[model samples]
Target: MGVCFSTIKVSGSNSNNNVNHNRKEATKQQTKTTKATAPTRKKQEVVDHQQNNKNVNNEEEKKLKVKEKQGSKAIPCGKRTDFGYDKDFGMRYTIGKLLGHGQFGYTYVATDKANGDRVAVKRIEKNKMILPIAVEDVKREVKILRELTGHENVVQFYNALEDDSYVYIVMELCEGGELLDRILSKKDSRYTEKDAAVVVRQMLKVAAQCHLHGLVHRDMKPENFLFKSTKEDTPLKATDFGLSDFIKPGRKFQDIVGSAYYVAPEVLKRKSGPESDVWSIGVITYILLCGRRPFWDKTEDGIFKEVLKNKPDFRRKPWPTISTSARDFVNKLLVKDPRARLTAAQALSHPWVREGGSASEIPIDISVLSNMRQFVKYSRLKQFALRALASTINEEELADLKDQFDAIDVDKNGAISLEEMRQVVFSLSNL
Candidate 1:
């Protein structure tokens, strides 16, 4: 029952403008104001000149001023700028139709002129934008992203360039809308715990990889976890490494960052590590299980207090049928003791996710239901599936079964999740 990215083919909409704006606002940092200067002999040019003549003054020479090298065209996994901004629009993407807009950039369906395949283009401006952090963040995102290409849960990127006024990132685009959007739409209500288990497994796998690479995704939320195929058959991808960091081993950052609802206590306190991402994953997983966020606050102050307290309302969640073992798994993840919580690998081994105690393959078939009617039918089947699943499953197996369903249900209609399955199990128990 895992949600499949391929199942949801959202037509590009004007509403995407909001998404772009959001990315922009989140990533765009304030830049220092400086007098605009004309293009001078680039420091690369001067460096080249010095290489040919060692008799020059070593004390007063500048950097990057050497003669232009053709190899300077584009560095592999290195940032490059091949596009420019529209005079009025700020940054312009020439190859594709605009698909979405973020606060500081526009995402486009672009064609890779070199390969002839269409790709998504995210545009940004470096010097002019009010947000100063956008430049550095985007740079780090590209660097980290390029290193994570083959992972199943991470999004793939290609050319990342910085132009005169803007920066451009061309990469694989997931056409399915955000999981947050699907959850909010109230169109899906039948997804099962079997679904969520699959997603969790994939996420853990990717998170472990990131942790191994010394990278930590400071921001982890539904919006950041993207669906690759949008069906029960495929898997969900971990997207947006913009706020990520590759700290040297045992190092930490003090930046107060991440989405308010999903931000971990350590993040707000400006002390963080890979565990910060794990906490975020817990919040996202909790949201998947229940219809609402685990820690909900009407005000920013309240939200902060809730996080600081490290208290979660398990008693309030409507999972009367939830198996104790499955609940135990979530409890372990949501634990305040970072040391006590299960590592990604340990979580994947939980029984709720296993099918008959065997490691089952990911369900990728649901990717075919891309249309509205298909989704409607899919939702109906999902509900029916949930009711039947509750009575038949082993309690210990719920953990693994949950994400499997969520990954395939890509629509995120709350029809598939660990909590949803728990509800079904509760019903069975009552009867």
Candidate 2:
């Protein structure tokens, strides 16, 4: 049985606002959570900057100012903005309603004046490019999209334009909502193994293409994928290249990035590669087949631990009904050792997810969607509760806590190291 999703109805209760708020909170939490496990080079740089601020003389400051001015003038397209594109955004397109907004800028629906076709325009404000790396990330995203947009599954990039204030990236508009929204809007919140195979196959194809081009899509959660239209068989397009980076042969990315549920074990270990993208696909596939996250917990730390230590549970209700080939496909992708895990190309050839494979047409149990919905709701509530708890505490109440933290922070670097925390835990455990 093929799964069909209905258009999501928005009530007057501002449910959309709530959902957006939760998503933002989730993003913030994921960033905070990953810091506990990832390398602290960025943190160390901040500490170094703070320390350097005390010793800098006026002569050094003036020299630094001169260098900054020289660097600014050396850049292209005037000032600090250089998008390598024409700045005729006013002539080419008419911007319409705001689709969404993020830290950098807002996304809007726009019309191509030439053909009267609608497109999505991501307008990134130049002022928000506070860090050099932030500017480079935007440039790289455009470069990658320009290179990879030829693929069927990737979102089509129309043009990149820049002005003194903002950079505009116009691309194909996906009228259909996110993949997660489609799953939640399903009539019975269920998909047959065959239906799942179709979705997974597209995702694997995208992964294969990205890997072929030596790009690692560090973030590949459901929210990053969208249907080109609202049709039942609309082609899914992979979007969002903010966290993506190019990888040379035998090179691995050290930065930990990605959503909590979809992040791979190697990512937490700070040595991720293209295989990590496959791991994320495995996570998505597990959720698709079982309607629940393979690695999950009430806390992000716990979720990371689960991803590192626990194997996905396949003895549950939907898994029992799922085919052996399907189970094997997921197993190979979710392997803890990236070396042992299936490559994107290898996974595309798996018997379960491959075209015309043994995936069953029987619909999975309806409870699968129910579980997924509950999981999302529970996560939001948990985040709300944590926020409430945090808001209740003030700096005065944390004075004693700060003292204890400072004592344990042997380097006096304003942050405790993982080794220091582990030693403390070990001593306490023995007591």
Candidate 3:
């Protein structure tokens, strides 16, 4: 995720609109170097900027103004203005605050003066689109979004307009923030199985729609899932088609792109298809059910190592409480073999999804409560290994937690510190 620019009022005189737009374009590009990347996967997709834009001061503006800037056409405002604010996008959209930015451009929550509707405008500065591949990626993103218009679970692409300095993309505003933020913000840090089912169903619906339209969203993660509105049951719409591409039937993509936590095993192996997105949904399902990541590790390498070799932790505290159908659903999609994994349509038809997991009012299990109490006491590394071990444990060995400890001590670093034990004991007493 990119930095979210704080909302600033742009209700000033329209005299400096072109200068302000250019300043924003330059600020967004300068901030590109700040994008976070995996240590091992240095070449990940150039993500867009975060929400909200800060107004640049005059001195900074002078220093940062685009050197070879050309267009400064003023947009005609008022009710009769053409769509997307006539030809000059700056005139129509008074960029209020920077919403977010990416390698290609910045996203702003712009006000459409003519309609009074809030629209998210992604500004892809032509000056920064230096390489052919980068330019093509932007084109592909626009093309995919255009083709997938009117999808219920995908972001609505209203218009894509370009001037000499920037390509402006107007899209439906998702006011509810990322699905990841929603999950993590919960007090218990978890969604009910029924809620998970609803979320996963929406995600799968988008995935199915994309596949049906001959496209593949190479990157599918919680951050990409945004709520359509602030309503309680507002649909989660998938956004960010930067890493997406058109795929013909039977074609396999070899690009290893995607956020580490939700990437599929086949992607790590350099072969991926629509099933890869299914695998990501499985990861999201696990997180939705439990607050924790299934194959988490401190480092990207450690995470990838687990993704390549480890099964998701189904025997862990939360899993023990999770319904059997829910477990089966996740297990089907997280299969190590892509061929064995469930497709989006198939996963959508799973019993748990069909029934909407456990009912919303259902209570979580005591075992899950107890395990979560003890689980949080462990060091990050130990917790990581324990979760990984939990997935591999069979039902027959459920009673003896100790029996699985040695198996999880993969590096033979077996000593549990007295301080750690004391912390666990103290946590248990409080529980």
Candidate 4:
């Protein structure tokens, strides 16, 4: 979610002038206060201002004292006093150096006493969980992680423990750094199509699995994926399910969540489902191959506008050199209409992505082929009926039909081919 912006410079003359002006104003005010007559309006106003300042200072000091007391107790102000969980974190693990920190908590390296296993411990301060929904988010994250345990692409969850002031979540430690770090470390900030395919394939599988479990990872970005090790062929593990939710069938989430760059069009429109996750994966795939964001700007709102209104540029230098199948793969995934967009499972089967781009033939599932055949049969029947009606109609009515046909005939060959029909059929099938 981090964005880099260019630094702005201020003229030295302007900066120095402003500082001198401020200092002059301060001196004038001091001189006026010192020369003010007793019981004057200006003197009374200054006295009132001084009293207000003192009051504000006293309040701040009290707040600081309260914060220090809270720090000592290690407890936050909350309605709920006790979490029905084990409090044996100190007995089981020896906490180590800090690994990272976020809004709600900090993650640290910890060693299990029983087996000396190195683990990542996430310590979330209870003070930060001020709202009821905040506490629910933590509980849901732990539950989802527990449910998704044993999946090769997901980070393993070991245990959840709570002390007086914080909740400790112990999970598998990944030392290979974030996926974003890996991409930034690359020679040109991009991967070859084949290498990109390998990374994207794993991401698609994770998305597919999450969808299968009826979960939607609201935030799906490179930063959320971590490598298991520093090896060249290290396994990628998905982490940080803070924004994720378990969605029911046919339901859409209304909240606007997720990083701006990877958010889907439907999400900005206030209706999102598992399809949003696929859109995020598509953004990631685009970055992996191009070394730049498909939709980007100086601000988050500008990025969202680009995502909703603009198509990814494929005529640029690297994109022009990229393969046709790879472009096709990205096009399908980045389709604005979520229904027409490729599902995670379908994306995994795409020729450019299947088997890490080594797949030679399109593997059409029997059911999909059967659906296509039935669609063809129905289309033929409709065509016959339309032809019969056309014979009875005049040239003016036939003109409308001609325009429609021309639209479908993308090659302008005066006839539609199987490839054109397939495109129509693919959109229909998704619907």
Candidate 5:
């Protein structure tokens, strides 16, 4: 939802022009989680993940009572004027700025007339819903938002109303804007490992809440996360459920809907569950610390291929500044096997996450960075020979190198393929 992102230069590249060009192209043709909906995708039969979970509407009901006490009812503003704004929707909100558009609709910032409170109104045009699938997608989004209404890490859903032309979804406005913007705006231009831990912890909490409520946020990109205000530590709330679904725990989801960079390996394989969201969080964590993507290419299809196969390069520059515990956490989440990936709750409890801001004080590994610089320039034959040589070295003394070698051998075939070596070679040639 609200798909937009700046380009991130890949390893060994001296220019970000290719990244910027690809980002522009990707913005024009954003993937909307329908890849899994293809006819050839196979459906798997598994027990529902929600059978053991109860709906959390008690919080929603309490919030509703509070809103009612404030007399915040949607009032008709009479005739449509001002470029489609109902003079007054439910007689309460006066639409303001056009925030952004998602896969199924547009979102606007609106003013609450009664007390001047700001809110976001997502408008889904009825005429655009020519397919039954599109209509159901809208309904499912509304349902998931209503179910997770009062969760602190979720954007609160105030009301959902339908008119002849559009379906309006009103909720709290995130004035600080997208989490991506906030991350980009950081004074230092990048988050420290500790700072990234805080962000990832918040993301996991939201994911944990959503999963517990039997919902899977099919699209968990940074664009879907928003800061409530301008405060540095403002709570991050997950938004835009357009591609989300009520996925039960054990049941698999075949719909391949999500941004290319953050989509999980299983989602590409046409079988996914809540763990898919965790994989996305891992990608976010990787970007948060390094100001680059772990898996990136010049095209969306290339990016998808990398996500489905390539292992994250934890031996890259900025990564040496990150803590061992932090790398360990990311490794666990980015696991190719969804079942082996850390659950949201488990990620929240990770040593890196639990350590929080304290992890920033850990000393950087200067030697590792020097080693990476040399490693990046290695030839395909040399890379393979080095890996073979690494196996003969004392594992404890050269543990980091051993791990780096293994990461490049992503397929775990015990030998690095020319295709794998080309990933680094191509980046170097681009320089």
Candidate 6:
């Protein structure tokens, strides 16, 4: 994520170097279903496998078939080239201009000579190449990106390749422009409440997806978010999943990773999980409304400390006035305890996020739930088998899922049913 954005200035943008709103200033804001849901399930719909062309190789079927760079029968681990590019799918593209460099990677625009298509290529250097300390950082990022899927709000990956030189990830190219550049350049850039709500809600939508996948995008900020107001194609794909991590069941991460301005408190002590991402969401929320970071300072160490220690003084906020729901939503995510924080899905339900649902959440009408890649990978042969076995359960079969959630009474006192389970699944779907 590029926190240090260029200050060249732009027309019709947000104002300032930092936001003046305090945590107290954000007062308010305030999912799921039975059956497997399409990412954008507003109501009910069934997959008519037999009614559709399930026999022939259709275009939609092909897209649904996830061609993992690692899973292709022709591109198995052993057969893959030294750079891991499949010989069957050789490098038929010429590398184009260097787009830009981030903390650990460089992006380039490339031309695929094979199809005459243009694509964005991200190259990641091994962390150990620089220093031992950077290893964890690199792993945190790669692991999270690879683990997450099926979310319209998060970044999408076309492929991951391992070469002697570096790890190359191919992704959709976003040309709109970085929010940071606009934020820095505009003298009076005030994102309207509707725009702010939509952006935050969309972000939370992605964040919610991450939580469901058991991963944490530890870094959340405007810089990490890519916006494309210029183009009429796609708005933007969330960029930079390097600081992400998959927190296992009944577990959390102990690495303090992410940008200082958006770091969550639990992150400072190297112990965090879904809540850490929520904290970053809060920081981004502050920036979108106030047109500046919630916390700002000169020194990196000082900024880190501020994230850990101080709270924003609402009186210091530059805005003449702010909404009550907005303040409430920020407070929910900024909570110090990980467990106390609102889940991303819940955040979406907040009034601040839903107030402008038309402009923000539903504008693009994206729903990662229906992602073909997800159904191909996650709803694979194994999942089919598991669900099949689950159907055959007597009294004992209920124990497995119940055991997964110890929240229910051991004696089954609490009537937490599959309905509740499905709700939780959607709430944490972004994970």
Better of 3 and 4 by TM-score: 4
The number of clashing residue pairs in each candidate reads 101, 0, 21, 0, 11, 37
Report the lDDT tens digits of candidate 1 across residue range 86-195: 24222333566876554456777876555567677777644323222334566677889889988767778666766555677777877656664443343544455555
Global local distance difference test of model 6: 0.59
Ranking by lDDT: 2, 4, 5, 3, 1, 6
Across 346-402, the per-residue lDDT of candidate 4 in tens digits comes to 999998998836522332223322332343355458657765765686544544465
Clashes of 5: 11
lDDT of each: 0.61, 0.83, 0.71, 0.79, 0.72, 0.59
Task: Score residue 9 of candidate 3 by CA lDDT.
Answer: 35
Candidate 5 lDDT: 0.72
TM-scores for the candidates: 0.58, 0.72, 0.64, 0.65, 0.63, 0.57
Please give the lDDT score at residue 124 for candidate 2: 88
lDDT string, candidate 3, 1-431, tens digits = 12222222344345366456756776786666454335324443222111112234554566556432312111211111222323777667778788766545789998888889999999876645433455667777888989988988888998877776677889999988888555444566344667668888999999999889888897898778899887877889999998888887888876568877888888877678888888898988877776567888888778989999988877767667677878888889899898888888888888788653443546555343344344334434664676577668653344234334444434333333334566667878998
Runs with alpha carbons beyond 4 Å of true place in candidate 4: 1-81, 184-191, 356-431
lDDT of 6 by residue, 125-241 (tens): 552233333444554555566665445655656666655546667766666666544433334433355656766777787787787888777777666677644542345457787
Best by lDDT: 2
Task: Rate residue 201 of model 2 by lDDT.
Answer: 94
For candidate 6, the 10 contiguous residues with the lowest summed lDDT are 361-370
Q: Which ten residues in a row have the lowest lDDT in candidate 1?
A: 30-39
lDDT of 4: 0.79
Best prediction by TM-score: 2
Task: List where candidate 6 sits over 4 angstroms from the true fold.
Answer: 1-90, 125-150, 162-164, 182-190, 232-234, 317-320, 355-431
Tens-place lDDT digits, model 5, residues 1-431:
12222224224353466557666677555554346454334332122323223244566777879887534222112112112323347677788889877434789988888899889999877655543455767777778988998888899998777667677889989888776566546564434566667778888988999889888887887778889999977898999888788876567976467877788999877689999999999988776665567888877679988987789998778677677787888899999998788899988888888743345754344443333233233323554675577557652345345457677876764345567898968878999
In angstroms, what RMSD does candidate 2 have relative to the true structure?
28.8
